[model samples]
Target: MMTTYLERASHALALVCRVVAGIALVALLAVTIADVSTRYLYRLTEGAIALRVTGSVELVSYLMLCSLLAAMAANVEKSQVVVEAFSHGLAPAIKNRLHGVYLLGFAALGLVLFLGLVDSAQSAAGHGEVTQDLRLPMSPIYYAAAALSLLLGVRSLIEALLGALFGRDAEVSHGE
Candidate 1:
């Protein structure tokens, strides 16, 4: 019963990650297109593209950052690579306990990374760095990406923990 619930919840979260990744990719593409078009228009005219492309071009970095984070989340949710050779040889009970311990360690590591990201965001904000033309703060975007990465790490930890506690949804094989 608990396994069923956890699997369903994990599936739902994975779906959400897919949607977010798709949206971020689309947004990045649109921004890139705009940047290109503006640059071309400026080339056709005088060398006045700086005014049109300055601030908007800078946003490309943020958009790309977002896309990468979203894609990473989706990947982690859907398919995580692991070396199963050792686990396959282990007894079922031992395998479950080992998996549980691994997930707990990963969760602890994620917590540390989350704290570091938060601190970095705070330090960046305190420094008051702004975009060249738009004067928009960059810390927010960094923090958002960091938060997404943290969420992905946490979600993976949860999935692993659940699988370790309950029997995994998939059949276990001694062979690859």
Candidate 2:
């Protein structure tokens, strides 16, 4: 069967999110290693190197948050936890409809989170919120998080609709 534009878009979005999340994780790892190495060098050289990363803590924290939010969409799409005890006895059609309802509910929750994040981003921007160490603006991170939430929301909605229309077969697969 031919793929829909929405499916293509969802796939693209998931790919992008996963890629970003991977990059963020790598960056976090690299930063942590660098920070630890610097600290060790400082201790060994008795302040000769003196090359402490001034904002390493704040930078790592931001990277962690970014990695988490960036992975959210792909996780929601592909790795949702299932309770087989609750679904094992149901007919496939019933199970699928239940899944659809669950997806829709998730989508609604995502939408609420997205809106709240947007508001928080705006407030942070207005207040000129910044990291104490780096003085990095917080609004951009919030905005990125809001965008990821929106992406998850839309992807969930689309999956829900497909499930409603096509039953079990319409459910999104990890292969996509």
Candidate 3:
């Protein structure tokens, strides 16, 4: 199939999101390991070793959010929990149309999330709010989340448009 420019762009963005998500997961794992190890050692030493990862909770929370948000752009269509038993009787074209409508709703949801993140980022910037425990600026994190949300919206919108225009009935594969 001849892919459109929008599809190409979305694919590239998915690649980027995948890389970032992987990084976030790795970072999260490292932080968790370090925190657990230090806490264990501190307990064993009976206050002799007063060393523990400060704000590990904050770090994990941020990384977890980033990883999940980063993954949405790539997996929105591919990772849906499809229940075909109810729609099994529908014609293929109708199924395709219904799926397109579902995708449209998902796109709208992503757009709304994007807007909310941007607004929160603006408010955080104005108030100079930082995260609890770790004093990391919240605005930047919100902006990053906003970008991911926008990417998800665009990817979903493009997929919906393509599916509707091409009438993808036979090409629906719920596989990565």
- Angstrom error at residue 96, model 3: 3.0
For each candidate, what is the lDDT? 0.65, 0.77, 0.80
Task: Using TM-score, give the best candidate's number.
Answer: 3
Per-candidate TM vs. native?
0.71, 0.86, 0.87
Which is superior by TM-score, 2 or 3?
3
Candidate 3 deviant stretches above 4 angstroms: 91-93, 169-175
lDDT of 3 by residue, 44-65 (tens): 9997997889999999998998
**Residue-wise C-alpha lDDT for candidate 1, range 1-176, written one tens digit per residue:** 77667666656655676677788778778877887887888787788655355666667777776776666555443343446877768776666556655555555655676777788788779998776768987678668777767766765676676656664532242111
Per-model tally of clashing residue pairs: 0, 0, 0
Top model by lDDT, which number?
A: 3
**lDDT score of model 3?**
0.80
- After TM-score superposition, the amount by which residue 53's alpha carbon in candidate 2 deviates from its true location, in angstroms, is 1.4
Clashing pairs in 1: none
Model 2 lDDT per residue over 1-176, tens place: 32365566666777788898999999999999999999999999998988987799888998897788778776665544569999889787776667667788769977998999999999999999987898989899889888878877877777666555556434345464
Better of 1 and 3 by TM-score: 3
